[model samples]
Target chain A: MARVQANGVDHHVQVLPAKGAPLGTAVFVHGAFIDSLASFYFTLGPQFAEAGIDAVLYDLRGHGRSERPPTGYTLQDFTADLDALLDALRIEEPVHLVGNSFGGTIALDYAVHHPERAATVTVVESGPATQDWAHTMAGALDQATEQLPPEEALDWFVAEYGAIASTRQGDGRHDAHIRRLGRNAGKFIATTTIARDIPDGRVLSDGEVRQIRCPVLLINGSEGLVAEQTAWLAELLPGTQVRVVAGQKHSVLVEAAEEVGALALDFVITEADKAAALEASLDAALEGGRTR
Target chain B: MKAVKATQTPPIPDEAQVLAEISEMIMSVLGDYAPPEGDAAITLDSRFGDDLEMESIDLVTLSGRLAEWYGPEVNFAEYLASLELDEIIELTVGRLVSYVARSLRTAATAAAER
Candidate 1:
């Protein structure tokens, strides 16, 4: 419910503080296009809070309640937004970065650039921002930009998945939400440089990818778009754990929230505990040195 | 600036008042997508998903508005966390009104006791 100006844009943010003694903070970065902070708000935000981990959720620029300028939608812009948001919040401690889809790409890039600020990185159904990723994203965004402008395109979604879409989140089928999503998508694509900037943005090289030293967890659905990247990602990052949810797809974050929430909760708690133990030992060492 | 008053208990809104206030909040959140039936379409049994066609995100916006109007005493996020996901998806306007009314009354009572 708060609007904080970060990176010179008003970003809508919601923070769910830990229920008891705070273990750590986990900032959730949601997917682009039809997605917003509400994706995590209703699913993982509360779960994280109840688990003694502060959850930070925010709408990406040009996506939700946040102000949307006509341009500046590059990968680096998103990475800078995350950095400025942390500074605005005055959170100095390293945080566990959890991201979904395109959001995961941004999180991975941020971790690479600022390894000291990120304790652990969890990517759900996403891979690092490589040249291949940019090309695929360009194709998808091009298709959306072309198809979503027509009113008939919205009708097609309503006719196809309208019935079951009501019960599901982010299904892009509910009549009002679908229509609104289509309108918003059309406006965003037509007005902004996202479709161009994202694909043309900075991509990590193999050497840069290998530099991430913190623990990384890659969660993907068996049939998801990026499931194959798990093996290569494991090889690239040494401290990596992989979990492929059976009989799921790209929308696993919403489709299998219960399992994902549990997995994420366990990972954050374990990582937070390890971080606390390490900090305590370091403090003890310093105290011992001073006394001697 | 207005002169500050000592701590005092605010009046607890009745069910109808709460309903009216929440209905206004919903309309404001929905904006152009609001139903043609207008405020009358929002009733006790009107489902947020099926009737209003509200995504879960609308609730987040509504919760923000509620906090603005009622202050921190009416904690919408905590109240929502108490429910199962299905219950939230099937949430109704009346259920929210009841929660807000109850919370206001509880806050008023606590303030009076102090």
Candidate 2:
């Protein structure tokens, strides 16, 4: 794993270099629980870099190879980690943020909090971090916990989600998700701290969405788990537009990696920031004579 | 500042030699857990993940060794910074060897001109 120390913690980051002339940076954020950066790393992150854009995918705190300190699972903390990640990497310019599930919540929140730093926001089956979402997640956690204790739950996860992850990787490979989750199976399943700290619903208000200055691309299935919330979000942001991927629900990210990768590629190439990144990369490539 | 350039072709390690070195580097990086090496067919189209599934940390380590061997004229990190993720996945050892050859030639020519 390509590890980067951001916000004073180790984030397992997959840094794909650009293929052609550099265009812009596309940062991928993963959803919470059971999901990690590996989703984008193997699927779409490489596509962006191949298009001459820098691509970054990192395992959220407590998720993958990062140091899980037993705390700091809130949106504010997540957003702060994002901020410090860019800072540590010296990414001074604005970037395109692509988020999946809970990761989208942080992306939307970060966009609202730091409008100038975000060029565009693309969300895949995610809605704003709202009270409804918090309640839903909390309830879901409770429901699952009624069946928790880790051992049986993990067995279930392995049998169920593990199968899905295996299919995604194709072939009979059972590692990626299993490997990452296996590393944290005990801690993730046994603890409710993260679920407990998932800030009460409505993390971002309607007015806050209106404050967003960047373009937004919201991809969801017709009946995405967050279907109800997307409507509220669309009504609030002027630049927000929804694109529904056929036959995909909340698990759209995995089920439709190819389609999503194409959509993301088109979004980045069409964005105005492409020119700036291109010029900068050209300069870097032209500048020579640095001693080895 | 006045820049000095290169024009002559810079000496690069032979392709077979470089490939052998890279193969060894990969073996050490993957340790005992690495899968079977894709021989003969492992040409210019092979990649790190699809053709070779080493741990991510090993890839990072391999990248550093590449920089050391190729020097600054041919930086994999710099080259990758411009590549799309698909290209990274489709990256073959032969392709990298070709890139080093081309980049070295370009740098040599540039230095001589300067």
Candidate 3:
């Protein structure tokens, strides 16, 4: 666990180094609100490290252990935070950006803005920050701002989601974790301008999104909010691969971590191998020229 | 917050000491959301999820505390990665205590040899 000063904010960051020399680095951007770096820490972070990839996980501003400013929750702010974080870490090489939900939006925006630094873009249950996205986010945040303040609403959220969590885990016991999520979300909503800033944030035009030059992978649940966007995204970013996990929903990362981890591991390894091969061939060509 | 030098490592802690440390870490992480029964509720057989109501995030915080207290040899994330999702869900405090005790012993032996 490390507190990194980036973008003038104290960000909670965790770097899981690979067992040996790292093949590459994958920065995991977690969802917003109730989610944090912990989502990746327990799931894909270790897996990535064990597979010889350094996994970087960090809490976005206003969430988890990161310092929460009263405002500046714009998508641009998030993208800049990621940029400053990489600089703070002194990571100059291109990195694979893996994002979930709102984090994916940030990743997409970052790729659009910093195409040189992003090796590949992988989004799970997320989409780009477009006008439609802003509209949807406004409504959701407005609802959260309205409902999350009341004690009864929090209780209801705990009861409802706790049951779902238990059922999903097949534990047959209600989980108090839901309460933690509810309370944290409630506090965040009540205190910050995230609700307004996110929607009012800068959105990407189709042309801007089309500027992403890296390999892209989009994974979404069949019932997830962004599953339909897969086709449109692929059209915008040619050669984008879309994988829809059947009978799943927005919580695909937690619900199907093993599957998602495997897919991610394979993607990174494949991309790394291609990069290695390209480097080796270039080195050989240079050696051949020297011999001549 | 005990500081141990790499060259002058202390004796391996017993399971009881490890448990005490873990319990303290748990309390620190849980804070206001700690169980009503308090530290006493955290026993050998206490399941983190069911009994302590710890989510994965809590474990992440606890993992950080573990590293701070026990040093890098007791890698909670790597230890957890070795387990299946179900095994992690059903993990017990005793299981963690044993792992920490064993890791510390190994580290101590290596330090003495050095």
Q: Identify the leading candidate in terms of lDDT.
A: 3
Computed on C-alphas against the true complex, the DockQ of each candidate is 0.39, 0.06, 0.53
Q: Quality of candidate 3's docking, in CAPRI categories?
A: medium
1 against 2, candidate with superior DockQ: 1
Q: Going through the candidates in order, what fraction of the true interface contacts does each contain?
A: 0.30, 0.00, 0.52
Between which residue pairs do clashes occur in model 1?
none
Off by more than 4 A, model 2: A155-183, A199-202, A273-292, B1-114
What's the distance in Å from true for residue B111, model 1? Answer: 8.3
Interface RMSD of each: 3.1, 6.7, 2.2
After superposing candidate 1, which stretches have Cα over 4 Å from the reference?
A: A146-176, B1-7, B10-14, B32-39, B71-73, B78-87, B101-114
Tens digits of per-residue lDDT for model 1, A1-292: 7998999989999998889988889999998866888778877888898889899999999977899988889999999999999999999999999999889999999999999999999999898988778888787666555656556545554443333223343543335555666566666767899878888899999899999988889988876788656777888886798888887777777767778888888887898888889999999999999999
Worst 10 residues of 3 chain A by lDDT: A165-174
- Whole-model lDDT for model 2 versus the true structure? 0.71
Write one digit per residue (lDDT tens) for candidate 1, span B1-114.
Answer: 112332564567799888877877888899898877634568878888778877667888887788778877777877776666657766888898999989888888887799
For candidate 3, what is the DockQ?
0.53
Query: Which predicted model would earn the best DockQ?
Result: 3
C-alpha lDDT of all candidate models, in order = 0.81, 0.71, 0.84
- Who is ahead in DockQ, 1 or 3? 3
